[model samples]
Target: MKNVVSYLFLLFILGACSSTKEKTGTSQAEAIEQQTIRKIDVHAHYRYARPYLSSFFQDWIMQAVLVDVAKEDSTGINRSWKQYVDMDIENPGVFYLCSSLVGVGIDDPDFATKNIERLKNEIATGAKMVKVWKNFGMVTKDGSGQFIQIDDARLQPVWDFLKENGIPVMAHIGEPVQAWRPLDNPMNPHYEYYKNNPQYHAFAHPEIPSYETIIAARDRWIAANPDLPILCAHMGSMSHNVDMVAERLDKYPNMMVEPAARFGDLASQNSDKVKAFFVKYQDRIMFGTDFGNYDPAVDWTAEQLDAEQKDLDATYNDLWRYLSTTDSLVIRKQHTRGLGLPREVLEKVYFQNASNFLGLE
Candidate 1:
């Protein structure tokens, strides 16, 4: 009887030891997943046929030039995103999808009412945020043929709905400062684009609107609707000058800037100053690639798709290195070094700030 009792006691001890080991292993896995979750790209353009998507996407298109799929089909985009998410669900942080709204009939009297209902439906369907593009200030016009500034009173209902629902608006209000500069200027990152798409060049059409005018309209909107959250894309459209962007950040408490496709703009500045700017306002900036997937106008072969995936991997790594290291890199033809930000600051820029701002976490 004594021998039997001793053996049972030994078994109990061994069982406890095994359970502790398993718990430790699970915790280590969770920590590693958290690191991946720390990085989030707040801005990118993705097209899908579906109007509604869930709050979290498996693959968040770190960057795509363009993606063209059917207007009614969400399968392609959903599958791509799911594959990305499946990579490491335990980590629980990768990308949050923000869906866009089509401006099919802004001139109609029912536009706002219909869109408001649509926006509510989208939010119910899992959209985390809303995006309003440059068309508002650049191409869209009022009934009188005057360009519709972002602050146009006609859109008050939409703004009110967003404000009431606490849905942040990711607004790209105007073209980059380069759009107003001479097309021949080599310093302009958009030189090639403007050269090929001259219709968007502000230099060619003096009657359209001035940079200051557009900016003024955007600022006025922010001021008028102080409670509404705004995510200003492309460094608030002043990437050419960080000081100006900083000034606006200081002025607008409800605004945050996402640096997308403007790495060159920051790279051209003094690295120390730029790094300091990031560190100071870490909570107010987001890392975005502005990667888009547009329809290439032809059926993409498997090889073409593979090449694009390769390009995406390289681009994502490039931005990561720039933000998290001090190594020098040639970004957009400019030789610049990385910011080597601390882990805390990286946490904020990569994901924490976004989560807090969007109320996802």
Candidate 2:
């Protein structure tokens, strides 16, 4: 059984109503219908991180069975994802995955190839999207024990395989700037992992590449893999710069983005640029929550879990404000956060893009 809070959060996410709703010259129900679940959450994780041993979050490979949102059937995967987490389930769908072979000591080309084989078996079984987590930029290393990047040569074979299979990879690179800042949001409750894992807080070179440099590396990785339909997870992992993100989308036809767990500090700061990015490249962007059980670090301590909830609620509130509000403000470019977008655009972000990218229906 999952923890009480886990199930509770799931119920709230799926059951909680947005504080506001509107009809921009049409039926709201119709709008919801159009935007509903042709989508699959290409970036979600089915299992918890390494912290909680008995909790659902710790069941890395097959814990979806334990959630109210998870199902015995493949389609159940879609329903469970939304129903359990409180997303707009009207159009919940996507074959979510935790696609990272880099951390598995994938420095050897042979092992890399073999790992790809392992991944292929999973993909064969039903994995649609691949998730390259934040570890690459922060934790993962290579041969001779050095840090490997998102585009390390050793992992080329795996990249090639995904491209060949038409499986889109949701690559989440670079920690949020605050995640690195010792005093800022690192202590933010959602970041239970940082407390236990000292490695996350410690960086080899804080100022070496700079934030933009890491983004450049991320872009380079995408540019190098042209055939692979790649979704730059977390708004290309650069929520601070929407103009730059828009440029990336405009430049790369093969590329796309997901607005997962972002809309908070970003909307508060760059509302204008952010709005422009969403309105302009609306089709290229997908909606995501980055919601998963990152409870391992707090598994042994209830205090840590309590802290995480507060942070999560704050983040969720931001999403609600940004995505649901109809107010028109000018952060810089005169745009809106939750345009209550057209059904088509909503469908694109929530489902279609994921489907086309992953070759799912």
Top model by lDDT, which number?
A: 1
Report the Cα lDDT for candidate 1. Answer: 0.70
Off by over 4 Å in 1: 1-37, 48-95, 101-107, 295-303
Question: What alpha-carbon RMSD in Å does predicted model 2 have with respect to the real structure?
Answer: 11.0
Tell me the tens digit of each residue's lDDT in model 1 across 213-302.
999999999888889998898888898888998998899999999888888888888889999999989989987777745554266676
* Ten-residue region with minimum lDDT total, candidate 2: 59-68
lDDT (CA) per prediction? 0.70, 0.55
| Estimated TM-score for each candidate | 0.76, 0.64
The true-versus-predicted C-alpha distance at residue 161 of model 1, in Å, is 0.9
What C-alpha lDDT does candidate 2 achieve relative to the native structure? 0.55
